[model samples]
Target: MDRPLGPVPAHAALEALLPPTALLVPEPAPPWTAGWDERDENDGFRPDWLQVRRLVRELMPTPKSVTRERMAEAEKECGALGLDGLDGGEGDFATLWTTRTGAWLAEEIFEGLTRLCDVMDLEPRLRDFAEEYVRRGMTVEAARAFMLAQ
Candidate 1:
Protein backbone atom coordinates (compact mmCIF):
# COMPACT_ATOMS: atom_id res chain seq x y z
CA MET A 1 0.00 0.00 0.00
CA ASP A 2 1.92 3.01 -1.45
CA ARG A 3 1.41 5.88 -3.80
CA PRO A 4 3.14 8.78 -5.56
CA LEU A 5 2.73 10.89 -2.47
CA GLY A 6 3.82 9.79 0.99
CA PRO A 7 0.51 8.24 1.97
CA VAL A 8 -2.44 10.22 0.59
CA PRO A 9 -2.56 10.99 -3.09
CA ALA A 10 -1.87 14.52 -4.37
CA HIS A 11 -5.48 14.95 -5.46
CA ALA A 12 -7.14 14.07 -2.16
CA ALA A 13 -8.63 17.19 -0.53
CA LEU A 14 -11.64 18.53 1.31
CA GLU A 15 -14.58 20.48 0.03
CA ALA A 16 -14.66 23.19 2.64
CA LEU A 17 -17.13 25.40 0.84
CA LEU A 18 -20.10 23.05 0.55
CA PRO A 19 -21.45 19.81 1.92
CA PRO A 20 -21.12 16.95 -0.52
CA THR A 21 -24.51 16.40 -2.13
CA ALA A 22 -23.60 12.99 -3.48
CA LEU A 23 -22.19 11.61 -0.24
CA LEU A 24 -25.59 11.49 1.45
CA VAL A 25 -27.26 8.11 1.06
CA PRO A 26 -31.03 7.72 1.45
CA GLU A 27 -31.48 4.05 2.17
CA PRO A 28 -31.28 1.73 5.15
CA ALA A 29 -31.34 4.41 7.82
CA PRO A 30 -28.45 4.01 10.17
CA PRO A 31 -29.15 1.61 13.05
CA TRP A 32 -28.07 3.93 15.84
CA THR A 33 -30.58 6.53 14.68
CA ALA A 34 -32.93 5.16 17.27
CA GLY A 35 -32.82 6.58 20.81
CA TRP A 36 -29.76 8.66 20.05
CA ASP A 37 -30.96 11.53 22.20
CA GLU A 38 -31.50 9.27 25.18
CA ARG A 39 -27.80 8.34 25.30
CA ASP A 40 -25.60 9.73 28.04
CA GLU A 41 -24.04 12.97 26.91
CA ASN A 42 -21.05 12.48 29.19
CA ASP A 43 -20.00 9.49 27.15
CA GLY A 44 -18.31 9.72 23.72
CA PHE A 45 -21.70 10.17 22.14
CA ARG A 46 -21.89 13.13 19.78
CA PRO A 47 -23.87 15.82 21.49
CA ASP A 48 -27.28 16.27 19.91
CA TRP A 49 -27.43 19.96 20.80
CA LEU A 50 -24.07 20.77 19.28
CA GLN A 51 -25.77 20.84 15.90
CA VAL A 52 -28.34 23.43 17.00
CA ARG A 53 -25.91 25.56 18.98
CA ARG A 54 -22.20 25.45 19.52
CA LEU A 55 -21.25 23.41 22.55
CA VAL A 56 -18.79 26.00 23.79
CA ARG A 57 -19.51 29.12 21.84
CA GLU A 58 -16.48 31.03 23.05
CA LEU A 59 -14.01 28.17 22.65
CA MET A 60 -15.35 26.80 19.38
CA PRO A 61 -14.78 28.62 16.14
CA THR A 62 -17.73 29.79 14.14
CA PRO A 63 -18.85 27.17 11.64
CA LYS A 64 -17.79 27.66 8.06
CA SER A 65 -20.36 28.40 5.36
CA VAL A 66 -20.07 24.83 4.20
CA THR A 67 -20.83 23.68 7.71
CA ARG A 68 -24.12 25.51 7.55
CA GLU A 69 -24.72 24.05 4.12
CA ARG A 70 -23.96 20.60 5.46
CA MET A 71 -26.68 20.99 8.06
CA ALA A 72 -29.18 21.95 5.39
CA GLU A 73 -28.02 19.12 3.20
CA ALA A 74 -28.33 16.66 6.05
CA GLU A 75 -31.88 17.86 6.68
CA LYS A 76 -32.80 17.49 3.04
CA GLU A 77 -31.13 14.13 2.84
CA CYS A 78 -33.12 13.01 5.82
CA GLY A 79 -36.35 14.02 4.16
CA ALA A 80 -35.34 12.24 0.99
CA LEU A 81 -34.65 9.16 3.07
CA GLY A 82 -38.25 9.29 4.38
CA LEU A 83 -37.23 11.12 7.52
CA ASP A 84 -39.07 14.38 6.96
CA GLY A 85 -40.36 16.57 9.77
CA LEU A 86 -38.20 14.89 12.37
CA ASP A 87 -38.09 16.64 15.72
CA GLY A 88 -39.51 19.83 14.20
CA GLY A 89 -36.23 21.57 13.26
CA GLU A 90 -34.26 20.75 16.30
CA GLY A 91 -30.99 18.75 15.93
CA ASP A 92 -32.82 15.63 14.77
CA PHE A 93 -30.89 15.30 11.50
CA ALA A 94 -27.67 15.98 13.26
CA THR A 95 -28.51 13.34 15.82
CA LEU A 96 -29.32 10.88 13.08
CA TRP A 97 -26.32 11.58 10.90
CA THR A 98 -23.97 11.80 13.81
CA THR A 99 -25.21 8.71 15.56
CA ARG A 100 -25.46 6.57 12.49
CA THR A 101 -22.89 7.96 10.05
CA GLY A 102 -20.98 10.73 11.78
CA ALA A 103 -17.74 8.83 12.01
CA TRP A 104 -17.94 7.58 8.46
CA LEU A 105 -19.13 10.90 7.07
CA ALA A 106 -16.46 12.65 9.07
CA GLU A 107 -13.77 10.55 7.39
CA GLU A 108 -15.29 11.29 4.02
CA ILE A 109 -15.42 14.97 4.91
CA PHE A 110 -11.81 14.92 6.01
CA GLU A 111 -10.64 13.21 2.85
CA GLY A 112 -12.73 15.54 0.77
CA LEU A 113 -11.27 18.54 2.58
CA THR A 114 -7.76 17.21 2.12
CA ARG A 115 -8.35 16.96 -1.60
CA LEU A 116 -9.85 20.44 -1.57
CA CYS A 117 -6.85 21.80 0.25
CA ASP A 118 -4.56 20.18 -2.29
CA VAL A 119 -6.46 21.80 -5.15
CA MET A 120 -6.23 25.15 -3.38
CA ASP A 121 -2.48 24.68 -2.74
CA LEU A 122 -3.17 24.26 0.96
CA GLU A 123 -1.35 20.94 0.93
CA PRO A 124 1.32 22.23 3.23
CA ARG A 125 -1.19 22.53 6.04
CA LEU A 126 -2.53 19.04 5.39
CA ARG A 127 1.00 17.60 5.37
CA ASP A 128 1.81 19.31 8.63
CA PHE A 129 -1.37 18.16 10.35
CA ALA A 130 -3.47 15.36 8.90
CA GLU A 131 -1.11 13.49 6.57
CA GLU A 132 1.78 13.51 8.98
CA TYR A 133 -0.35 12.18 11.79
CA VAL A 134 -1.88 9.57 9.53
CA ARG A 135 1.46 8.73 7.89
CA ARG A 136 4.36 9.28 10.25
CA GLY A 137 3.23 7.98 13.61
CA MET A 138 0.62 7.60 16.24
CA THR A 139 -1.56 4.71 17.18
CA VAL A 140 -4.28 5.32 14.65
CA GLU A 141 -7.56 5.51 16.48
CA ALA A 142 -11.08 5.92 15.16
CA ALA A 143 -11.73 8.85 17.40
CA ARG A 144 -13.88 11.60 15.94
CA ALA A 145 -12.11 14.90 15.30
CA PHE A 146 -12.49 17.74 12.87
CA MET A 147 -9.50 17.46 10.50
CA LEU A 148 -9.50 20.83 8.75
CA ALA A 149 -7.86 23.66 10.63
CA GLN A 150 -8.60 26.35 8.10
Candidate 2:
Protein backbone atom coordinates (compact mmCIF):
# COMPACT_ATOMS: atom_id res chain seq x y z
CA MET A 1 0.00 0.00 0.00
CA ASP A 2 1.14 3.52 -0.71
CA ARG A 3 2.01 5.61 2.32
CA PRO A 4 -0.17 8.65 3.03
CA LEU A 5 1.51 12.06 2.59
CA GLY A 6 2.19 13.59 6.02
CA PRO A 7 3.49 16.82 7.56
CA VAL A 8 7.05 15.49 7.52
CA PRO A 9 6.85 14.66 3.82
CA ALA A 10 5.34 18.05 3.01
CA HIS A 11 8.05 19.83 5.02
CA ALA A 12 10.73 17.81 3.24
CA ALA A 13 9.27 18.79 -0.13
CA LEU A 14 9.28 22.49 0.89
CA GLU A 15 12.89 22.23 2.02
CA ALA A 16 13.95 20.66 -1.24
CA LEU A 17 12.26 23.42 -3.26
CA LEU A 18 14.07 26.18 -1.38
CA PRO A 19 17.66 27.34 -1.82
CA PRO A 20 20.32 25.08 -0.40
CA THR A 21 21.45 27.78 2.04
CA ALA A 22 17.91 28.55 3.21
CA LEU A 23 17.01 27.97 6.83
CA LEU A 24 14.17 25.54 7.48
CA VAL A 25 12.76 27.91 10.14
CA PRO A 26 12.90 31.65 10.61
CA GLU A 27 15.55 32.99 12.95
CA PRO A 28 14.46 34.44 16.29
CA ALA A 29 13.95 38.21 16.34
CA PRO A 30 16.36 40.27 18.42
CA PRO A 31 14.80 41.68 21.61
CA TRP A 32 16.47 45.03 21.01
CA THR A 33 14.52 45.52 17.74
CA ALA A 34 11.13 45.03 19.42
CA GLY A 35 10.53 48.73 19.98
CA TRP A 36 11.21 49.46 16.30
CA ASP A 37 8.01 47.55 15.42
CA GLU A 38 5.86 50.62 16.05
CA ARG A 39 7.97 52.73 13.71
CA ASP A 40 6.30 51.27 10.62
CA GLU A 41 2.82 50.97 12.17
CA ASN A 42 1.68 54.09 10.29
CA ASP A 43 3.17 52.99 6.99
CA GLY A 44 -0.21 52.00 5.63
CA PHE A 45 -1.46 55.56 6.04
CA ARG A 46 1.11 56.91 3.56
CA PRO A 47 -0.10 57.65 0.04
CA ASP A 48 1.12 55.38 -2.74
CA TRP A 49 2.92 57.83 -5.02
CA LEU A 50 3.30 55.28 -7.79
CA GLN A 51 -0.44 54.77 -7.91
CA VAL A 52 -0.94 58.51 -7.77
CA ARG A 53 1.31 58.99 -10.79
CA ARG A 54 -0.57 56.35 -12.72
CA LEU A 55 -3.90 58.00 -11.88
CA VAL A 56 -2.56 61.38 -12.93
CA ARG A 57 -1.28 59.94 -16.20
CA GLU A 58 -4.64 58.37 -16.92
CA LEU A 59 -6.45 61.58 -16.15
CA MET A 60 -4.17 63.44 -18.53
CA PRO A 61 -5.95 62.02 -21.59
CA THR A 62 -9.19 63.47 -20.29
CA PRO A 63 -9.55 66.89 -18.78
CA LYS A 64 -10.61 66.71 -15.14
CA SER A 65 -13.16 69.51 -15.20
CA VAL A 66 -13.19 70.77 -18.76
CA THR A 67 -14.81 69.31 -21.88
CA ARG A 68 -12.70 67.34 -24.37
CA GLU A 69 -12.93 70.03 -27.06
CA ARG A 70 -11.99 72.73 -24.57
CA MET A 71 -9.01 70.66 -23.45
CA ALA A 72 -7.81 70.30 -27.02
CA GLU A 73 -8.22 74.02 -27.58
CA ALA A 74 -6.36 74.72 -24.37
CA GLU A 75 -3.60 72.34 -25.44
CA LYS A 76 -3.22 74.23 -28.73
CA GLU A 77 -3.00 77.51 -26.88
CA CYS A 78 -0.51 75.99 -24.43
CA GLY A 79 1.55 74.75 -27.34
CA ALA A 80 1.56 78.26 -28.82
CA LEU A 81 2.96 79.31 -25.45
CA GLY A 82 5.70 76.60 -25.92
CA LEU A 83 4.20 73.97 -23.60
CA ASP A 84 4.66 70.36 -24.70
CA GLY A 85 1.45 68.57 -23.65
CA LEU A 86 -0.72 67.57 -20.72
CA ASP A 87 2.23 65.55 -19.40
CA GLY A 88 3.97 68.84 -18.71
CA GLY A 89 0.97 69.91 -16.68
CA GLU A 90 1.00 66.62 -14.78
CA GLY A 91 4.63 67.23 -13.89
CA ASP A 92 3.65 70.58 -12.47
CA PHE A 93 0.87 68.86 -10.54
CA ALA A 94 3.33 66.41 -9.02
CA THR A 95 5.60 69.26 -7.99
CA LEU A 96 2.70 71.14 -6.42
CA TRP A 97 1.45 68.08 -4.54
CA THR A 98 4.91 67.35 -3.21
CA THR A 99 5.34 70.92 -2.05
CA ARG A 100 1.90 71.12 -0.41
CA THR A 101 1.97 67.71 1.22
CA GLY A 102 5.55 67.99 2.51
CA ALA A 103 6.31 64.65 0.86
CA TRP A 104 8.01 64.33 -2.47
CA LEU A 105 7.13 61.23 -4.47
CA ALA A 106 10.58 60.93 -5.98
CA GLU A 107 12.13 61.07 -2.49
CA GLU A 108 9.85 58.28 -1.31
CA ILE A 109 10.73 56.20 -4.36
CA PHE A 110 14.41 56.84 -3.72
CA GLU A 111 14.06 55.77 -0.08
CA GLY A 112 12.31 52.53 -1.05
CA LEU A 113 14.92 51.79 -3.71
CA THR A 114 17.73 52.44 -1.24
CA ARG A 115 16.14 50.17 1.35
CA LEU A 116 15.99 47.39 -1.22
CA CYS A 117 19.63 48.05 -2.02
CA ASP A 118 20.45 47.76 1.69
CA VAL A 119 18.66 44.39 1.85
CA MET A 120 20.75 43.16 -1.08
CA ASP A 121 23.91 44.67 0.44
CA LEU A 122 24.37 46.80 -2.66
CA GLU A 123 25.77 50.35 -2.71
CA PRO A 124 23.28 53.14 -1.88
CA ARG A 125 24.86 55.82 -4.07
CA LEU A 126 22.62 54.77 -6.96
CA ARG A 127 19.72 56.63 -5.35
CA ASP A 128 21.39 60.04 -5.55
CA PHE A 129 22.76 59.32 -9.01
CA ALA A 130 19.31 58.37 -10.23
CA GLU A 131 17.93 61.66 -8.85
CA GLU A 132 20.57 63.57 -10.76
CA TYR A 133 19.89 61.64 -13.96
CA VAL A 134 16.17 62.38 -13.70
CA ARG A 135 16.94 66.01 -13.02
CA ARG A 136 18.90 66.03 -16.27
CA GLY A 137 15.88 64.77 -18.30
CA MET A 138 16.97 61.13 -18.53
CA THR A 139 14.22 58.55 -18.91
CA VAL A 140 13.42 56.28 -15.96
CA GLU A 141 14.69 53.27 -17.91
CA ALA A 142 17.96 55.07 -18.47
CA ALA A 143 18.17 55.94 -14.80
CA ARG A 144 17.54 52.30 -13.85
CA ALA A 145 20.27 51.14 -16.21
CA PHE A 146 22.70 53.66 -14.76
CA MET A 147 21.82 52.50 -11.24
CA LEU A 148 22.22 48.82 -12.10
CA ALA A 149 25.59 49.55 -13.61
CA GLN A 150 26.76 51.06 -10.32
Candidate 3:
Protein backbone atom coordinates (compact mmCIF):
# COMPACT_ATOMS: atom_id res chain seq x y z
CA MET A 1 0.00 0.00 0.00
CA ASP A 2 2.99 2.33 0.40
CA ARG A 3 4.08 4.56 -2.49
CA PRO A 4 7.09 6.77 -3.17
CA LEU A 5 6.86 10.47 -4.05
CA GLY A 6 7.16 11.66 -7.64
CA PRO A 7 9.51 14.26 -9.13
CA VAL A 8 9.92 17.45 -7.14
CA PRO A 9 10.82 21.06 -8.06
CA ALA A 10 14.44 20.58 -6.98
CA HIS A 11 14.80 17.73 -9.46
CA ALA A 12 14.03 20.11 -12.31
CA ALA A 13 16.78 22.45 -11.12
CA LEU A 14 19.19 19.55 -10.84
CA GLU A 15 18.35 18.44 -14.36
CA ALA A 16 19.07 21.92 -15.74
CA LEU A 17 22.53 21.85 -14.13
CA LEU A 18 23.45 18.56 -15.83
CA PRO A 19 24.38 18.07 -19.51
CA PRO A 20 21.39 17.90 -21.81
CA THR A 21 22.23 14.35 -22.90
CA ALA A 22 22.65 13.11 -19.34
CA LEU A 23 19.55 11.36 -18.05
CA LEU A 24 18.15 12.75 -14.81
CA VAL A 25 15.61 10.36 -13.48
CA PRO A 26 14.33 11.52 -10.11
CA GLU A 27 14.78 9.11 -7.26
CA PRO A 28 11.62 7.62 -5.84
CA ALA A 29 10.48 9.03 -2.50
CA PRO A 30 10.38 6.88 0.58
CA PRO A 31 7.38 4.58 1.01
CA TRP A 32 5.80 6.38 3.96
CA THR A 33 6.31 9.87 2.62
CA ALA A 34 4.80 12.75 4.64
CA GLY A 35 4.45 16.43 3.86
CA TRP A 36 5.68 19.35 5.97
CA ASP A 37 2.62 21.52 5.49
CA GLU A 38 1.72 24.01 8.29
CA ARG A 39 -1.34 21.97 9.31
CA ASP A 40 0.92 18.91 9.87
CA GLU A 41 4.23 20.42 10.91
CA ASN A 42 5.61 17.13 12.17
CA ASP A 43 7.70 15.71 9.30
CA GLY A 44 6.94 12.13 10.37
CA PHE A 45 9.06 9.17 11.61
CA ARG A 46 12.85 9.02 11.80
CA PRO A 47 14.79 5.87 10.96
CA ASP A 48 17.40 4.35 13.26
CA TRP A 49 21.11 4.45 12.43
CA LEU A 50 21.09 0.92 11.05
CA GLN A 51 18.18 1.62 8.75
CA VAL A 52 19.74 4.87 7.52
CA ARG A 53 23.06 3.23 6.71
CA ARG A 54 21.35 0.34 4.92
CA LEU A 55 19.14 2.59 2.80
CA VAL A 56 21.99 4.89 1.86
CA ARG A 57 24.30 2.02 1.07
CA GLU A 58 21.68 0.45 -1.14
CA LEU A 59 21.15 3.70 -3.09
CA MET A 60 24.70 5.04 -3.47
CA PRO A 61 27.71 3.16 -4.76
CA THR A 62 29.95 4.60 -2.03
CA PRO A 63 29.29 6.25 1.35
CA LYS A 64 31.69 9.20 0.84
CA SER A 65 29.46 11.29 -1.46
CA VAL A 66 26.15 11.19 0.44
CA THR A 67 24.18 14.42 -0.02
CA ARG A 68 21.62 16.03 2.28
CA GLU A 69 18.85 15.14 -0.16
CA ARG A 70 19.91 11.48 -0.19
CA MET A 71 20.03 11.46 3.61
CA ALA A 72 16.47 12.82 3.73
CA GLU A 73 15.30 10.03 1.45
CA ALA A 74 16.95 7.43 3.70
CA GLU A 75 15.20 8.90 6.73
CA LYS A 76 11.84 8.60 5.02
CA GLU A 77 12.53 4.93 4.19
CA CYS A 78 13.37 4.29 7.83
CA GLY A 79 10.05 5.78 8.87
CA ALA A 80 8.34 3.29 6.60
CA LEU A 81 10.06 0.46 8.45
CA GLY A 82 8.53 1.50 11.83
CA LEU A 83 11.86 2.64 13.27
CA ASP A 84 10.62 5.82 14.96
CA GLY A 85 10.19 4.22 18.40
CA LEU A 86 13.63 2.58 18.47
CA ASP A 87 16.25 4.06 20.83
CA GLY A 88 19.03 5.98 19.13
CA GLY A 89 21.83 3.44 18.75
CA GLU A 90 24.28 2.99 15.91
CA GLY A 91 23.95 -0.56 14.57
CA ASP A 92 24.43 -1.99 11.09
CA PHE A 93 23.57 -5.18 9.18
CA ALA A 94 26.81 -6.78 10.39
CA THR A 95 25.76 -6.42 14.02
CA LEU A 96 22.39 -8.06 13.41
CA TRP A 97 23.80 -10.97 11.35
CA THR A 98 26.62 -11.64 13.80
CA THR A 99 24.28 -11.92 16.78
CA ARG A 100 21.66 -14.13 15.12
CA THR A 101 23.48 -17.49 14.95
CA GLY A 102 25.14 -18.25 18.28
CA ALA A 103 23.24 -21.48 18.78
CA TRP A 104 22.39 -24.44 16.47
CA LEU A 105 21.48 -27.34 18.72
CA ALA A 106 18.04 -28.68 19.70
CA GLU A 107 17.96 -26.86 23.06
CA GLU A 108 18.88 -23.63 21.38
CA ILE A 109 16.24 -24.09 18.70
CA PHE A 110 13.60 -24.85 21.34
CA GLU A 111 14.55 -21.74 23.30
CA GLY A 112 14.44 -19.62 20.14
CA LEU A 113 10.96 -20.92 19.26
CA THR A 114 9.80 -20.05 22.77
CA ARG A 115 11.19 -16.53 22.43
CA LEU A 116 9.53 -16.17 19.05
CA CYS A 117 6.19 -17.07 20.59
CA ASP A 118 6.69 -14.48 23.33
CA VAL A 119 7.47 -11.76 20.80
CA MET A 120 4.40 -12.64 18.75
CA ASP A 121 2.19 -12.76 21.88
CA LEU A 122 1.30 -16.40 21.23
CA GLU A 123 0.69 -19.15 23.76
CA PRO A 124 3.85 -21.23 24.37
CA ARG A 125 3.75 -24.99 24.26
CA LEU A 126 6.43 -27.47 25.31
CA ARG A 127 7.50 -28.97 21.98
CA ASP A 128 9.04 -32.06 23.55
CA PHE A 129 8.42 -34.27 20.54
CA ALA A 130 10.13 -31.82 18.20
CA GLU A 131 13.00 -31.44 20.68
CA GLU A 132 13.51 -35.22 20.87
CA TYR A 133 13.54 -35.48 17.07
CA VAL A 134 16.16 -32.79 16.83
CA ARG A 135 18.33 -34.39 19.51
CA ARG A 136 18.53 -37.59 17.40
CA GLY A 137 20.17 -35.68 14.52
CA MET A 138 17.44 -36.71 12.08
CA THR A 139 16.67 -34.78 8.91
CA VAL A 140 13.90 -32.20 9.22
CA GLU A 141 11.42 -34.45 7.43
CA ALA A 142 12.21 -37.45 9.66
CA ALA A 143 12.08 -35.24 12.75
CA ARG A 144 8.68 -34.02 11.71
CA ALA A 145 7.53 -37.63 11.35
CA PHE A 146 8.82 -38.47 14.84
CA MET A 147 7.05 -35.43 16.22
CA LEU A 148 3.79 -36.53 14.58
CA ALA A 149 4.12 -40.01 16.13
CA GLN A 150 4.45 -38.54 19.67
Model 3 lDDT per residue over 40-98, tens place: 23554433433544555686434234455655565566678866412354444332211
Q: Considering only N, C-alpha and C atoms within 3 Å, which residue pairs clash in candidate 3? A: none
Over the full model, what C-alpha lDDT does candidate 3 score relative to the true structure? Answer: 0.35
- How big is the positional error of residue 69 in model 3, measured in Å on the Cα after superposition? 0.3
List ranges where model 2 is wrong by over 4 Å. Answer: 1-105, 123-150
Q: Tell me the TM-score of each prediction against the true structure.
A: 0.21, 0.21, 0.24
Clashes found in each candidate (C-alpha, N, C closer than 3 A): 12, 0, 0
Tens-place lDDT per residue, model 2, 112-147, is 453454345444444455645344332334345536
- Candidate 3: where is the Cα deviation over 4 Å? 1-48, 89-150
What residue pairs clash in candidate 2, if any at all? none
lDDT, candidate 1, 49-117, per-residue tens: 334333212222333332545666656644554444343345455543333333333344455454454
Q: Largest TM-score belongs to which candidate?
A: 3
Sort by lDDT, best first: 1, 2, 3
